[model samples]
Target: MGSGKHRWKISIYRSTGKPETRNPNPPTEFICPISGLLMADPVIVSTGQTFERACVTACKTLGYNPILKDGSIPDLSIVIPNLALKSSIFNWARASMTDPPKAVELADALKLVRPAMAENGEIENGVLGELLIGRVEEDNRGSNLLEHAESELTRRQTGFDSCESLSGSFRKTPLALATRPSCYSSCSSSSELDAPAVGACEDGEEYVGKLRSSHVYEQEQGVVGLRKATRSSEDLRLSLCTPRLLSALRPLITSKYNNIQINSVAALVNLSLQKLNKVKIVRAGFVPLLIDVLRGRFPEAQEHACGALFSLALDDANKTAIGVLGALQPLVHIMIRSESERARHDAALALYHLSLVQSNRLKLVKLGSVQLFLGMVKSGQMPGRALLILCNLAACNEGRGAMLDAGAVEFFVGLLREGGFDSESTRESCVAAISALSYGGGLRFRGLAKAAGAVEVLRDVAEQTGRERARDKARRVLEILKAREEEEEEDVDWEKVLELGFPSRTLTRVGGQSCRNSSEF
Candidate 1:
């Protein structure tokens, strides 16, 4: 009996040695499947199964495919940094259409793991990863999925549409599903699909479908065509049109084609400026929407929006509205940050226009926008803009001291010296700066001439002036300096006139001719 018991015990121990029955409660720590190191954390398998980190890692490293919960190969199986995961997902979504089903499946799997992915301050990465995965899935499924996704997106986007209906849906159900022509047509064709009849509310208002005009519909179609053509064309010709295009684009800005309203507004703004009807547009409440577009993400839209604001600001009636909107700060910001030189130039010109109003100039100075103008002058990226802004600033008595302190004289002198007298703009800016300094009581003409190299530059400019008017300007400056010097001197310097290379013979001949001319008179 004892021998029998010993044999039974041996058999029991043998049964326990089998792999499946080895441990009822497996050890938490195990060797990593990939690195052969002890697992530090639990591994989540694609099948919603957790394993030892060591095992999963080793399985991945050795090419042992792990299945996801949906019976697909795991998309992202490797442990990676949060930023790396986010970047990978973003790139995947961006290129998702080109990738095959396996990549799409992987993205979907990564998306599933996103919530758990944010263990320690990786929330942004997790959220972005999930979005990327969703994008990939939608892209892989093609048009049907895209339509559905867009419908959902449109529904979500409706909240900010308009103010008329705050408590109820912002858009009609048909419009939300309008991306798919069949869906829209079927819903519109069937009276049964008309939204569940909303009854009259306590406020005695009956729910009704917002009716749109045929003109708006046509404008929307035109805008879509223009966008598509612009996407394909190098010159974007379809996007550019004369004022006549406004008759076509204006209706699209109304509620009928709300999705394309912003685009329509931009096109109309461009056309309006071309037509020089900005005054009318600004008075019609176009400024607020245009300002919003200027703050939007699309570069082209932002550019046109700024351009429209600038054109509107040029009108005296619209200037107050622009200031009330607190537009100067954002306009200045765009001028400083925009990569487009034309946009920067327009922004500067707009500021100059605003500066025409005394209050606007003071407000801009209070806002410290003058520093940006100074930077532009010092950097010399846009000399025309700098010159205009300086001219505007000098228009204000309060701004004159600031302009001088900011080295306006130096910049104008440099422009005059480096930019030849033939340059009308440089000559104008120089003369303006000199006149401002001389009148502002802040500039001693003598000190300015000696310190800013004004004497030599003016002398050269005077000689280069083929125009009688320009010669007179240069001669006047020279005369002012000579008169100032004479007043400061004790003795006459008639003997030194020859030493100084004066045209003595020309002077003597002129004097003799003057005497003869007087006798003749």
Candidate 2:
């Protein structure tokens, strides 16, 4: 018996009306000893008289000794020899032959020899036999045979010798024989490769008689082949229209498929949005579909859908289109209800974009969305998202007042004191608030500065302003308030001002008038 490290390269030479080369180099060919089929380069044999060093090693690890010999004729009576030799030959032929029909014919020929070889004692207890049995059991139990085979093979002793003679066969030890049945059970038919064999065995007729049935092999082979073919075809097909396929797959988003669909949709939408006219297609329908998907039953799906919508909403046209579909409420619902961080973030972003448009801004305010947004900021959940929404909310006149009435300044001040305003979003929100107050209707300005402690908060932010932008904004607001104070000072009643601050000035004037009257008298 050989170890797994030494692999045998078997070559089967089949007459394709051409001279075949057999050598240690390229274009190697051999005639399978059992099936007499022409095999080509890199033939791997686990049984029969042509087993290579590596194949012998592998078989030895499995507690079996495989033989090897050079011959033009194959012995078809031996089950294991014929099956292993025929497999090697067919594999070689399939690799070398460019014509599909030729390969198919070779595969068919190998199939024909399978049963005859299986009927003999040669195929029983062989690697394929153990593999087949294990596959069948696995299929029944819906387990994996390869995993089981690997574990079993690991427990066996495997080694190799130099100058190894290929004539003798290695026999399994008592322990190996004892474990064979269990190995077979472990590999029974659930393995991916077993499908084809099962399909091959579906027929009622007995295949090889005593050793094994042909119908079982045929059915297993059929199923296995079909599965492999389906996977291969799907791989090729999906690669072609991946973008469109992903976009269409959006509705199918679920916890099980959320990542796939989201990634797919994101790629497609991103690519499409880059193009000028294609953006319309996405805006017209994709936005709504994404919004609808946000209502999914799974948190993952909602998360992914919200992310996709956020990417789409980055486009101005798409944002307006989303607003037109009345997406604000549904988005808000997801933001508030869904616990997914991604969903909440995206929903907040969508709201922020919607607020940029005046009509949508008013609508959001009218819906009492400002209160909810302010509450989100106050709660300290998703502070970045909340700040973005707040910034956009401050962009509108009514929205600014609503935010003021909703106590946004106090909440924002709390955020600043709590260090929540350290982020860029919070800083941006602060800037937007300052701008809105400075230019917003005077009542809003007075109300905000005079309200509980807004001016102090503003002064704090102003003190912390190291950046030119922040300092400039703070300077502008301060200048506007100072100018308003000066204007109010000029309009004050002089008489009332004197009475309050200088009653003596009025008394002096009255004394001077009385002195002049006395002089006249």
Candidate 3:
């Protein structure tokens, strides 16, 4: 299916061909408790539970110590490779791989997805969606003894001819991004993160659905759709968005299948564009689940999860749940990893919205967000959201103190002068952050601000910028700079100055449309 044909992509399918050969039963001794499938390489953990080596290793890396029904985990570390189990599994696979399929198994699985094609040549999306979920569950339960669903899936993935034919019936991959040139132009660059963070499908309904259909949103997850859609209309109709749909879609968001999980998250993100859906999703217990995905290291999933959380965070009630779940560190990790610039941008935007709450603000400070923000903003990578995030964090004293300690004051001052005040919002944010740092920071803060040329930058802005808010914020920081300049005239304690905020290592190299002239102190 093309990007726009989302609604009627699936319903009935042609039996096309007989289902692949499968054995309906396998030796029980081959299964691993963790994966519920024949173990490729089993290992016994310190707790005496035998699991697929990959599963146990993943749990170990993620710190997931499983608790059985008795609520006990004997030990997590002492893992030993089970050579005996491996030999048995290899023998089982050798036998099972060539087994003939039971006629019932072939008929039943195909019947689930191949009901009847509609007159319009469309299929019911629900049909294929359900079939995919069934396949995943059956694989988890080891229900199909022959041609295990996962092995079948692997065959489809590796066999080019099979995959090509499957693609014709399924939108089996992410929609090609080339079709959405307008939506992607800015997102392809870091500039969009600096701008308003909205505009992709910022307006239409069909386009919104189409974007939500993209499974590999490694790019900004089309977040612009949610931000714009939510802002354009506030008269929400709860009936238009059903609780059942939310209930059915939530589990898909957490599915182990990345394609299914991404599409599900994007669908919810589309619904969240409505003001009411934001509260409803949070009420449906989605916030915690979404944050859990962020904590797990799924690159593509993280991009979508952060975007959904960013939209949901627009509501005040959801902010507490997100923050209380300790979402800060994971968000910071995204910024540091650069897995996808889209994930980084969305994560920053999520933090920006979450920072509206004071408690979240404190958590952000303690989590070393200031350092991350400084790194991003200083480099002008994802600068728009970075500056905006910094602006929000600058609202509180702890955030401001973190910024100073991270040596962000000088950077903000230089930013205030860059591009000759072309971006009003970024300029305003820079001024505001400077003002926050200057206030209650005593002489040291002011000295750092002045040394960064805050007085000169703010003066230039006050005279040249037309935006009253920018003019006002700049003028206030300027006043502080002038007052502090007079106070620290000759007794410039270099140590005191050095202690507050870091001096720009490249003060002479003004970045992103340089307008820098001279140092302040």
lDDT of 1 by residue, 164-240 (tens): 21112112121111111111111111122222222212110110111123444443445544433322222332234
Model 1 CA deviation exceeding 4 Å by range: 1-219, 222-262, 274-277, 420-424, 440-449, 466-521
Per-model TM-score on C-alpha atoms: 0.42, 0.45, 0.46
Q: Estimate, for each residue in 275-297, the C-alpha lDDT of model 3 and write its tens digit.
A: 44667888888877787787765
How are the candidates ranked when ordered by lDDT, highest leading? 3, 1, 2
lDDT of 2 by residue, 1-521 (tens): 36433333232234334564442221233543333434332233312234222332223223232222331111111123345544555555456553211222434444544554444333423343333423435234212312322222222111111102211111211122222111122222223422223322222122113112134344333323322222223222223223343333333333133333333333333233221323444643566666666765545446545655554554444556667777788888887777765466556655655565556777788888878876776676655556556655665678778877777666665555556453543564555455454453265575566564655665666778454444445555565666677777788777797666633322235447522322223
lDDT of every predicted structure (CA atoms): 0.46, 0.45, 0.54
- True-structure lDDT of candidate 2: 0.45
Q: Please give the RMSD to the true structure for each candidate, in Å.
A: 28.7, 32.3, 27.6
For candidate 1, what is the TM-score?
0.42
Best by TM-score: 3
Which pairs of residues collide in model 3?
10-123, 10-124, 11-123, 11-124, 23-145, 23-146, 24-145, 194-384
- Which candidate, 2 or 3, would have the higher lDDT against the true structure? 3
On lDDT, the stronger of 1 and 3 is 3
Error of 2 at 254 (Å): 9.6
How many pairs of residues in model 3 come into backbone collision?
8
